[model samples]
Target: MLIIPAEKSLDWKNPPWMTLALMLACLVIFVFYQGKDPRLLHTAVQHYLDQGLDRLEAPIYETYLEREIRLEGEADRRTDLEAFRETVAAGERASLAVTMLMDRPFFDYLLANRDLLMNGRQRQYWTEARVPIQQNLINEISAYEAGLVPAEPSLYTLVSYQFLHGGWGHLIGNLVFLFLLGFTVEKALGPGRYLLAYLMCGVFSALIYTGFSWGSKIPLVGASGSISGLMGMYVAFFGMRRIRFFYFLGVYFNYFRAPALAILPVWIGKELYDYWAAGSTGIAYMAHAGGLVAGAGLILLLGKGWFQAREAFHEPEQEEQDRQFTHDYADAMEALARMDFTLARKRFEALWRDYPDRPVVLEHLYQLAKLRPDLAEYRQRTRELLNQYLKLQQPDNLLRTWQEYLELGEAIHPLEAEEHNRVLFAALRQDDLKVAEKAFARVRDTGHRELVREAGRLLADEFGKRRMEPKANEYRLLLKTL
Candidate 1:
C-alpha cells in the first residue's frame, strides 16, 4: 500500500529550488559515482575468484554461518543461512565471494580467524588482493565514511549517507517520495531552512537507528530517511487542514480528503510495526520512524504558522465538483454491491443525468435497467451503453460489458448493423471469439457482407488453431457464401 499527498501539482512559475537541487544531486551521483558500483563489484569479485579467495573464505564463511545458525536459533535467519549455504555449494564463485567481500561483518569475522582459516601463503595472497578492493572499490562509493555504519557513526556519515543508494530501484523510490514531499516542504520552509531540516532529520534518523542496532556492522545507505522527514513535514505543515491524498490498496486506487495529521499516525504506525516485525529485512524502519518524528517535531517547534501553504501549487479546476461526485460514485457502487437495486438505480441515474460524460455511470445504469426489461428504460439504457461500448477504447471492459449484456438477454430496439459490426470488430481486436461470433451472427444477414467475410476468415483461423476443424470449416463455408 502507498499513500501520497495529491493536493498540489507542479507549477512552472514558482519552482522548488532546494528540492530540485537535491533530486539533481541524487540523480547525478547515481549516474556518475554509483554507476561504477556494478563494474567495481564485478572486478573485485572476479579478482577474489582469480586469486582463489573463495577456497579460503568459503570454508571459513560456511563455518561462521553454521555457528550463527546454531547460536541464534532464529527461524528466519536460519532459513537465510541455509539459502546462503546453497549458493556456496552451487559453485557460484562470484556470488559466494561477494558476500564476504562486501559484507563488513563477514570481513571482521575473517579477520578474527585469519590464522584459523589461512596458512602463510594463502593469508599473504588474500591480504594483497583484499587491500585494493577495499580501498579503491568499496571505499570509493560504499565507503564506510559515506554510508551510515551504526557501529561507527560520525557526523559526516549521518549527513552523507542520505546521498548514497543501494540500487537503481532504491534511488528511484527515494526520488519519487523526495519530489512528492520535498517541493511542498521546501516551499514552506524556504530553501535554506529546508536543506538544514533535511540534514537534521537524517542525522536524527541515523541516531535512532544506531540506538536500536548498535555495534552492527551493516552500512545503511539511502535517502529513505530524509524522504521520510519530508513526509512528516508535509503532515505537520498542513496539520488539521483537509487535503487530498492518493492511495492504493494493491489492486484499485482512489483519492480521499482527510486531515493531514490523520495520516501521520498511519505512517508512523506502519514504520513502528515494520521495525519490530522485519528487524532483519535490511530496511532501517527505525530510521524512517525517527525521520518522521523529527520532521514533525521541528515543524511544530517552529510553529505551524511559520510554514505556509504552497500558493504556487496547481489545484485541479474541477476539484471542488469532483469531490462530491467521487463520494456519490462510491456510495452508488456500495449500493450495487449490497444488491440494493432501487437505491443503486436512483443514485446512478442521478449521476448520469447530472454528469453525462461519466460512461461508467451508464454501464451501471444499464446493468440495473436489464433487470426491469419490461420498462422502456431497458431499451433506452441498452442503446445508450451499446453506443458507449463502441465509442470507448477499453477493450477489456468492452468485452466484459458485451458478455454481461448477452448473458442478461439485452437487445437494442431496431438493432443497427453498423453498431453490431463495430462491436464485432472490437471483440475481434481483443481476439474474443465468443463475443465476436455472437456479434457477427447478429450482422451476418445484413448488408455488411465484406465485414462478415473478413471476420469469418479471422474466426476460421482462430478455430483452426484451437484444433476445432469442423468449427473452422463452418466459418470457412460462411466466408465462401459472403
Candidate 2:
C-alpha cells in the first residue's frame, strides 16, 4: 500500500533550484563516488589475503570463538562458532579474512594478543595490509565515513548521511519521494526557508536515531528520513485544507480529496508500527517517524508567522473560466429575449468576438443581419457561418449546412476553391451525387491541380461504388488525359 499528496503543478517559470541541486548532489555522489564501492571492497579483501594475515588471525579467532561459546550460553551462537572453525579448517581464509577484520570484538581480542601471536616481520605485514584497507576500503568508505553512526554521531555526519546510499535501489526509492514531495514544499516555504527546513528535519531524524540506537557502530544512510520530513511538512504546511491524494492498494488505485493534515497520523502510526512490529528490517522507521513529527513541529513553530497560505495544496472550488462564460452568455441571452436588437447585437458581437465558434451566436447574428442587411454585414456573416459549419467533421451535416447557405441567399457567393475542396471531399465521402458533380466541376476549373486529380480518382471510385458505371467510366477516362 502507498499514499501521497497529488499536488505540484510545476511552473517552469520558477525552477526549484534547491530541490534540483539536492537531487543532483545525491546522483553525482552515488554514480561517481559511491559507485566505486565494489572495487574498493575487493581491493581491501585482496590486501588481507596477500598479507597472509588470515593464517595468523584464524587460530586466534578460533580460540576466541571457543571461549565465547562457553560464556555465550546460546545453542545457535555456539553452532555458528563451530561452523567458523570448520570454515577455517576448509582453507577458505581469503573470504574469512574480511569477516575477521570487520569483527570489531575479535579485532580487539587480536590486538590484545598481537605480540604473542606474531613475529616482528609478520606484524609489519599486518600493519601494512590491514590499516589501509580498514581505513579507506572497509569501515571508512563512502557510506561509513560520511553516514550517520549512532555510536559516534556528529554534526557533519548527521547532515552528510542524507547524501549517501547503500545501493541503487536505496538511492532511487528515496529520490522518487524527494521529487514528488520536495517541489511543493520548496515552493511553499520558498527555497531559502525550505532548505533550512529540509536540513533541520534530517538533523532531527539523525538525533532521534541516535537516541534509539546509541553506541552502535552500524552507519545509517539514505535520504528517507529527510523525505519523510517533507511528507510531514506537506501536511502541516497546508493544515486543514482539502487536497487531492493518490493511493494505491496493490491491484487498485484512485484519487480522493481529504483534509491535508488528516494523513499525518496515518503516516506516523505506520512508521512506528513497522518499526515495532516488523522486527529489524534494515529500514530506519524510527527516523522516519521522528522526521515526520519534527517537520510538523518546525512548521508549527515558525510557519504561520513566517509565510502566506499554502498554494501547493489549494484546489479550485469552481472553474473561473467556465463560470464567467456562463454568466456572460446568460446576460447576452437575456438582452436578446427582451427584443433589444441593438443591445442584443452589441452583447452578441462581443460574445462572438470572444467566442467566435459559438453556433448560437452565428445563428442569431445571421438573423439580425437579415433584418438589417443595410448594415452590409449579411454577406460576411453568411460566409463566416458557412465556414464554421464546414468545420463540422460529419459530411452529412456539412452538406446540410451547404444547402442552408444556398437557401440563405441567391446573392451569397459559394465558398472559395480552397474552401470548396472541403465540400468536394465531404460530398464524395458521403456519395451526395448532385453536390459532388457540381463540386467536381468547380474544383476541376479552379482548384489545385494535384487536388483536382486526387478528387477525380476518388469521385470515380465513389461512382463505381454507387454502380453508376457510365459516370464512373466517364471520369476514369478523363483522369487518363489529366
State which candidate has the highest lDDT: 1
All candidates: CA RMSD (Å): 17.4, 11.2
> What TM-score does candidate 2 reach?
0.59
Worst 10 residues of 2 by lDDT: 312-321
lDDT of each residue in 1-482, candidate 1, tens digit only = 88888776665577988899999998897788777778888887887778787787777777777787778654555766777788977877777777778777778876677777789988787678876777777666564647888899888899888999888898898998899888878767778878988988989988998998898878888889888888888888778989989999989999999999889989999999987787578788999999999888888887445444445332343565599789999999999999999999999989988788889899888878878776678767776787776676776766666566555554544346666677788887887788888888877766778777776887898889989999999998877775
lDDT of each: 0.80, 0.78
lDDT of 2: 0.78
lDDT of 2 by residue, 86-119 (tens): 7877877766876686665566566667677778
After aligning candidate 2 to the native by TM-score, how far in Å is the CA of 161 from where it should be? 0.9
Query: Lowest-scoring 10 consecutive residues by lDDT in candidate 1?
Result: 308-317
